[model samples]
Target: MQTSTETETFGFIVNDISRLIRAEMDRRTTEAGLGLTTGEGRVLLNVRRFGPTRQNLLAERLGVEAMTLSGLVDRLESKGYVERQPDPADRRAKLVTLTDEGEAVVCGMEPITAAIRADAARGIDPDDWQLLLAVLKVARNNLMAARAEAQSAESAAA
Candidate 1:
């Protein structure tokens, strides 16, 4: 069995790196005056990518609680970044869609995102960076699958 110190050396490095990267992005986003917290930006990006989606589904996609997502949606709605409309097919549900300002904010994020990516990739060979990204993608997918399996087991047991 791996000792705690051994686990920390590998698993913890990956976890810590993720946290650090997020922290850096949060700092840079705030400094850029994007008028968004990192969590808000994450919500906006998700909505932009798969919008016109129900609130519960969005919350699931973001791996956040429904109430937490609702709060974020409320803030974004007030800021004109997103609008929540009653789902035509399901009145009890609300769909989140990006507004014109939200689209503009997403567009403006391109440069900021590029700069951050460039900084993060600094000194790394392009090929190595590409490989690292590919590996991370698979790792993320594996983790997601594991979470889904666990959820399914819990649901079945219940």
Candidate 2:
């Protein structure tokens, strides 16, 4: 019932790929016995990648609600995988950092993610892979800019 053109649109393809990748990550992480839900794994990896980020900023980056992130952080903290510390520059804001155990879990995740990347890139040439990454980066930046512009306009109109 679906036409090739409809399925080939940028939004359709990108969304489909994103869903598939998330599902694969969930399955792989479970099989690896990381004892994390996909959302928790994502939080850990993002924290490892960004390092000691403020909770609000981390929520924005992760495209999650602050309350949702708070719940996840609570669980991770209870598991001895992460800790929340008051931000030095903002007394009221909290920063999230991975505990040693979280770092260990992230280290364990690296190979699994690398394998997924390898599998996804299997048929692509090195140059094409680099090009694909570059293109996606540009697309992401453009979308972020658009969102910022809309937010600015909304604030100005208020």
Candidate 3:
């Protein structure tokens, strides 16, 4: 078993990277003229990241409630950055896609965002970054597996 000291190391380093990425993202996006709230930016990013996605799936991926995501989508739609269309798979479902303008913005932001990510990752050796990413990926899998096991156990207990 990993000692508590090892767990603390995992927690701190993971949290530090998460903070640096998020804070830098917030700063850079604000400079991009959208001045988007984190939620709004997340809505745009998720749309871009996963291609067209159902509104419910977007909410689930963002870990936000569907109703809250509804408001976020509403704001994004008003900005003309996203479009919601009926899902071809399910007529009642709405699929969100980036508008042409939104696509342009996303394209433009890509390099700038990359620069910020690179800056945040600066000072770390490339090999270290690779190793860190590998470790983080395993950490993510472990956490997800643990969560699934816990949920399954609770469901059976219930």
Candidate 4:
């Protein structure tokens, strides 16, 4: 029932909507005391939510390179927000965890985070929202696996 032109228009609308939501999140998050960059806020969140996580695994989850991850960790560690401990099974590896200060920082931003997510979803019917979520999840899985495969191929080629 859908035409190609209509589908294209819908894609453009979705892209613009996604951009607007991201910009709003950036604006409100900056207004919070998170400071500097969105990456910092994201790092704080990850360390708070997924800390005691291995550095490599954290880097993979963030979809960032090791150097980038290290830099984020450095800033957080300096702020007394995070710390690295030796992995029990791997002496060469370290686990990252959030300090009490880090938790406080993330907790303080909770209201803003919830507000942003809710605003982005405003006016969407429950069924439509769930359908969009399901489709997006499938698309995300395909893209992620494809990206990993492409990276592996490039590495092999190099």
Candidate 5:
């Protein structure tokens, strides 16, 4: 068995990589003049990905609090990047959608994102990159399952 000092742990390596990627994306987005905070950009991307999702659901997916997401949405909406509409299925809730302007911004972001991804994958074999993605997906799913189990247990206890 390898001692902690002898080898980097999986969590530490994964987290460091995540942090570096976020920092690089933040820098590139700023340099690109996207006029968006990292959180705001993430919100826009996720909104596009999920397609007119309810605000609460979007917040949950992003692992942020609803109120925090609301503020981000407000800023994006003010910038004409996103619009919040009454949720047809739930009158009390609002659904977030990317505006035409938002779509254009997302398009503008594409090159920056691609460049960052390429930089991160530099020197890694294509097969190894694919394997890394697969491993990360499995790890994410495992964590999600564990979270669900913990939540269920808490609900049962309560």
Candidate 6:
């Protein structure tokens, strides 16, 4: 029932915008001399946001491959930004926590992120922005629910 063009509009438009936003964020991070790639910055921010957590958990939250997350964490650890300690709750599992230097990077990122967000929303009305956020949140929840349902069905079949 759906036209190809109509079906494609949502995905392409959203994907393009997401890509551009990431590119702009990467540019700003480099211009600010943050000494982090966009991906690294993202990991740093997530660690800061969630506190000390397992690498696998962080990978899940970031929607990245575990190996990729491991590499990022390793780099960050060598740079003195993060450290991996044996999780108290699970000795076999390691928890990634930010060090003082990592905290500094997280602090430094706040203003840059704010500026980037402000720049992106420059012409948008605050009310409209809030409404847009609400719609997106619903869409995200719906997708998550669908994924969970599919996983459940797959597990049952197995």
Q: Which candidate's TM-score is highest?
A: 2
**Per-residue alpha-carbon lDDT of model 5 for 45-87, expressed as tens digits?**
9988889999988999888999999999999999999999999
Candidate 2 per-residue C-alpha lDDT over 1-158 given as tens digits, one digit per residue, 9 for 90 to 100: 87565678789989888888788889999999988887898899999999999999999988899999999999999999999999999999999999999999999999989988998899999999999999999999999999999999999999
Instruction: Return the clash pairs for model 4, or none.
Output: none
Best by lDDT: 2
lDDT of 6 by residue, 85-105 (tens): 999999999999999999999
Give, for candidate 4, the lowest lDDT window spanning 10 residues: 2-11
Candidate 5 residue runs with Cα over 4 Å from true position: 1-7
Q: Between prediction 1 and prediction 2, which has the larger TM-score?
A: 2
Can you give the TM-score per candidate against the true fold? 0.84, 0.93, 0.80, 0.74, 0.90, 0.90
lDDT of each: 0.86, 0.93, 0.84, 0.82, 0.91, 0.90
TM-score of 3: 0.80
The backbone clash count of each candidate, in order, is 0, 0, 0, 0, 0, 0
Measured with C-alpha atoms, the lDDT of residue 98 in candidate 1 is 94
Candidate 1 yields a Cα-based lDDT of: 0.86
Candidate 2 ranges beyond 4 A from true positions: 1-5
Q: After superposition, how far is residue 12 of candidate 4 from its true place, in Å?
A: 7.6
- Greater-lDDT candidate between 4 and 5: 5
Candidate 4 lDDT, 48-151, residue by residue in tens: 77658898998888778999999999998999988999999998999998899888888877888889768767999978888998998987799899999999
What is the overall TM-score of model 2 with all chains considered together?
0.93
